[model samples]
Target: MKLGFIGTGKITAAVVQGLCTSGIDGLSIAVSPRNEATSSFLAQHFSNVRRMHSNQQVLDHADIVCIAVRPDQAAHVLSQLRFREDHIVVSFVSFLTCHELVRAVAPARQSCRAIPLPSVIHHTCPIPVFPAIGPVMDLFSTIGQPVTVDNETQLHALWTLTGLISPFYDLLGSLSDWTVSHGVRPDTASQFTADLFQSLAHAARQSDPIAFDALAHHAATPNGMNEQAAHEILASGAHQAYRQACDRLVQRFPILDE
Candidate 1:
């Protein structure tokens, strides 16, 4: 497949990295000129990747065009490009509806919205949603697990879930900092927190039919250290604060109508 990326940002770089590392055959990537450093880096490290002179060149030369621009810049970028009827256009920009994509690339037949994280580079599980279209399903599945959604609302929900990752990381960082302040070495604190999460993730994956809440309850036994910490967090409303943050993200999702 001849693939082109319209905005060469972090996500685009991650996707290109994933594709290059996956050893998938017959793949050629052309990246936009917006992030010159990333585009040049990919071209230098990957044999099949090239840097296009302009975004239009990406649309003109590639069979599958990916729009990776920020939501605010999407309309302006689309307004300046052209696409053929048979071209497949996939967007990583959240909340832009398929209809909006169709209108952007006027004559395109296939349009899809996909969400991919940096984890995709390792072929680890990635949250991918395509409202419609089969090719995107097949393509992303090669890089990670892919889920198909039937409507735009579900796609928006998926996007909100993606937005949760950053704050989750911040929460972990706070926990790590707390440990460091308590005299744990900084490196040891960070490593311990990372390993703890890794172990928890692995446990969740391995424990079939075991409910997560049940696992947490078991870990937080009556009068135990875990239970005491949990109580303090709940009493301080930290959990509620996280929930409100998530709610705000849902409210701020960048729909095409905006």
Candidate 2:
């Protein structure tokens, strides 16, 4: 299968890198010239990857077309390209609804919206795709766990959770700084912080049936440091603040009704 990407940004780079190393056979990946560094890097490093001079060149040769442009640039970029009925259009534009994508890529009967994070580069992360397309699902699953949702509203809700990634990093950074202030070496503190969460995340993934609250409670003993910290954080409304932030982000991406 031939794959084409319209915007060669971070997410595009990650997905391309994932696919190139995913062991998927007979795949030729073409990327836009928008991000020269990323495009050149992929083309130079991957034998199956090519850097296209223009967006149209990608569409002209690819069976599957991926739209990864910025939200603001989506209209102008997509308006210039023409899609065929056989093209499978997958959009990574967070704010672009399925309705808008169908209109933008008219005559392309197949289209879906997807959210892939940087973890995709490491073949780790949840890829939430709306209105599941078989080939697309197969492709994403090779790199990450793909969750298919038929409802656009629910898909938008999942996308809202992806927004928490930055806040998650901030929490890790703050904890690392706390450790560093206590005389720990910078590299040691950073490694500990990352490894600690990685182990926790791995446990969560392995124990699929376990409730998150149960795990949280399991980590805290009565009158323990974990319990005290959890109590203080709850008292400060930190969890509620995170929920409010998610609500605000959900409002930013509205899905149109059919």
Candidate 3:
């Protein structure tokens, strides 16, 4: 199958690298020339990839087209391209909705919203949120686990979760920096924090299904250091600040209706 990416940015490059390494047969990709460095890099590094002169060229050559532009640029960029009813258009732009895209590319057979992080490049599995489409489900299944959403609201919730990633990384970085200040080497502190978090995440995933609060309680004993620290942070408004940040995301990207 032929796949074309409309925007050759970081996320697009990651997806292209992931697909290239996946060794999926007969898969060829054409990316737009907007991000020349990344597009050229992919073309040079991947035998099956090519850098296209324009976004329209990508749509012209591929069976599956991924609209990888930012939400702000989506309307303007999509206004210039044309698509057929049979083409599959998967958009990674967060604020754009299926209905809006359908209107942008009238008569397209299938259109879905997908939110993929750079992790897809390592075949670590992308969290895909589709509005119940079989072809999209089949395509993303090859890269990672596919999640289907019943409505656009749920999809927006998924997007909100995506927004949390950067803040989460910042929190981790702050903790790692504190360790470095306490005398550990910078690299060692970051690595230790990452490894410890990875193990904790793995354990949480494998453990019996239970409320996260229960696990937190088990991990933090009564009047212990962990509990004391947790209480102090909560008292310092850290937890509330995180909640407010999430609320702000929801407000910024209001839920799209079905």
Candidate 4:
């Protein structure tokens, strides 16, 4: 299979790295040269990876094309490229619905929208895709669990929750800084904070029919620290704030419109 990447940003870099390291033989990868450092690095490090001179060149060389351009640049950049009717286009552009992408890449009959987090490099994340396509889902499965959604609205909701990732890290950082303020070593504090969340997430993932409320009840003993903290956060409107933030983020996607 031949694959082409239009933007060599961090997500593209991570996906390329994962694909190269994945044990998928007889696969050729082509990357646009816009992000020279990343494109050059992937080309130099991977045997089957090639750095192409232009976006058009990348499209010309591959059977499947993955668009990873930023939202602002997606329309303008894609307008210049010519895609064949036989080529498959999988987009990672946030806020750009599949309808918009189809218009942008006309003649390309197969178009898919995918959301792949940075952890995809570790082959550990849920890759959500809209309007399920066999080849796109199969390709994403190599890097993460591919979840094919029936509608764009459901897919956009998953994409909206992804916006909370940064906030999650910031919350962890704040907890780590609290420990530091209480005299814990900086490195130790950071490591503990990260591991605490990682183990919690792992546990949640392993549980069958997992429920947030069930986990909360299991963790919070009577008058225990966990219960106290949960009460404090919830009573302080932190949980409500999180919901509001997610709702706002979802509004940015036009597909979610009523």
Candidate 5:
């Protein structure tokens, strides 16, 4: 199958690298020259990937097109390209609705919204794809865990959760810093914190039937350090503050899917 990407940014590079190394056969990729460095890097690194001279050229050569352009640039960029009636479009551009994309990529009857995290480079992230058409589903499934939601509202809510990634890394950094201050080497502390969180995440993923609250309870024995820290954090209202932030973000979403 031929896959083309209209923008060559980090997300695009990650998806391309994942797909190229995915062992999914008969896949060739066309990338736009919008970002020359990234496009050139992919074409040079992956034998099956090709760098196109233009965005229209990407659409012209591939059956399925993925748009990874910024939200602010989407309307302007899409206005210049033409899509075919048979083309299937998957947009990685946030804040752009399926309705808007359908109009922009008119005649390309099918389209979907997707949010892929940087972890997709490792082919292990949860890629939430709205509408979940078969061809797009297959693409996401190859690179990451494909999450199909009922509507765009649900998809947007999931995307909002992605905003927490930085906060998560910050938490890890804080832990690593504390360890370093307490005499551990910087690299040792960083590695320990990263591996610790990774193991916790792995355990959470493995515990499919377990609710997060239940998992937390299981890890926290009475008067134990985990319980003590959990109590203090709850008392500090940090979790409530995070929820409030998420509510504010959802309110700011431009797409009126509600």
Candidate 6:
């Protein structure tokens, strides 16, 4: 399998790192030289990966080309590149629908839209893909749980959820700070706070039906501390605020009228 990436940003770097360490045979990668530091780092660390002088060079180097450029640069960047009919392009640019991307990468009959988290470096994360392109799906499955959606609306909803990464970290940071204020060591506080959430998530994943309310109810016994915390968080409308924030973010990806 051969892969090339047009942009060497964080997500691209993560994907490259994961794929290189994934132990897949006959795999080679080429990355554009736009982000010299990242491209250099990958080339230096991975034997199968190399840096290309231009986006066109990257495209020519691999059968599958991934676009990781910023949303603002997507149109301009792709407009300048030439694609082959056999090429399969996967785009990481937000708000660029598969249709728009297909037009941008014309001559390329196969295209996919995807956004993977940095956790992919560990070969474990949710990778949301659209249209269920088989090769793209198979490739992502090697590194993460590839969840394919039938419609763009659901894809947009999933992308909106990605915005919560920072807020989720803040929640953990706040809890760690609270413990530090009580005289706990900073390292111990951070580790305990992170482990608490990770364990909770793992437990929730084990639930057969995976009902959040059911899990919350189980954790929050009659007038227990867990119940107190849940009550305060929900009663303050923090949960609803997350929904509203998602609503706002989803608006950023308007339905592209055909």
In model 1, the Cα lDDT at residue 23 comes to 78
State the C-alpha lDDT per candidate. Answer: 0.85, 0.93, 0.84, 0.92, 0.92, 0.93
**RMSD in angstroms, candidate 2?**
1.2
lDDT of 4 by residue, 78-97 (tens): 99999999999999999898
Candidate 4, lDDT over the whole model: 0.92
Q: Candidate 6 lDDT, tens digit per residue, 1-258?
A: 999999999999999999998988899999999899999999999999999999999999999899999999999999999999999999999979878998999999999899888999999999999878899988998899999787888888899999999999998999899999999999999999999899999999888999998998888989899999998999999999999999999999968663
lDDT of 2 by residue, 144-223 (tens): 99997878998998999988989999999999999999999999999999999999988987886968898999989999
Per-prediction TM-score: 0.91, 0.97, 0.94, 0.96, 0.97, 0.98
Candidate 1 yields a Cα-based lDDT of: 0.85
lDDT of 5 by residue, 1-258 (tens): 999999999999999999998999999999999699999999999999999998999999999999999989999999999899999999998889888989999989889989988888899999999889899998889889999899888988999898888888998999899999999999999999999999988898888785899989999999999999999999999999889989988876675645
Cα lDDT tens digits, model 3, 196-248, are 98888887877789467877888898889989988899899988987887788
Residues 142-216 of candidate 1: C-alpha lDDT, one tens digit per residue: 778888776676777677777778887987899999999999999999999999998998898788786888788
TM-score of 1: 0.91
Check candidate 4 and list the clashing pairs. none
RMSD of 1: 2.3
Candidates sorted on TM-score, descending: 6, 5, 2, 4, 3, 1
Give candidate 2 misplaced runs (Cα > 4 Å).
none
Off by over 4 Å in 6: none
Off by over 4 Å in 4: 255-258
Q: By TM-score, is 1 or 2 better?
A: 2
For model 5, state the Cα shift of residue 234 in Å: 0.8
Which one is best on TM-score? 6
Q: Which stretches of candidate 3 lie over 4 Å from their true place?
A: none
Q: What is the lDDT of residue 193 in candidate 4?
A: 96
Query: Candidate 6 local accuracy as lDDT?
Result: 0.93
Ten residues in sequence with the least summed lDDT for candidate 2: 249-258
C-alpha positional error of residue 117 in candidate 3 after TM-score superposition, expressed in Å:
0.7
Clashing pairs in 5: none
Candidate No. with top lDDT: 2
Selected candidate, larger lDDT, 1 vs 5: 5
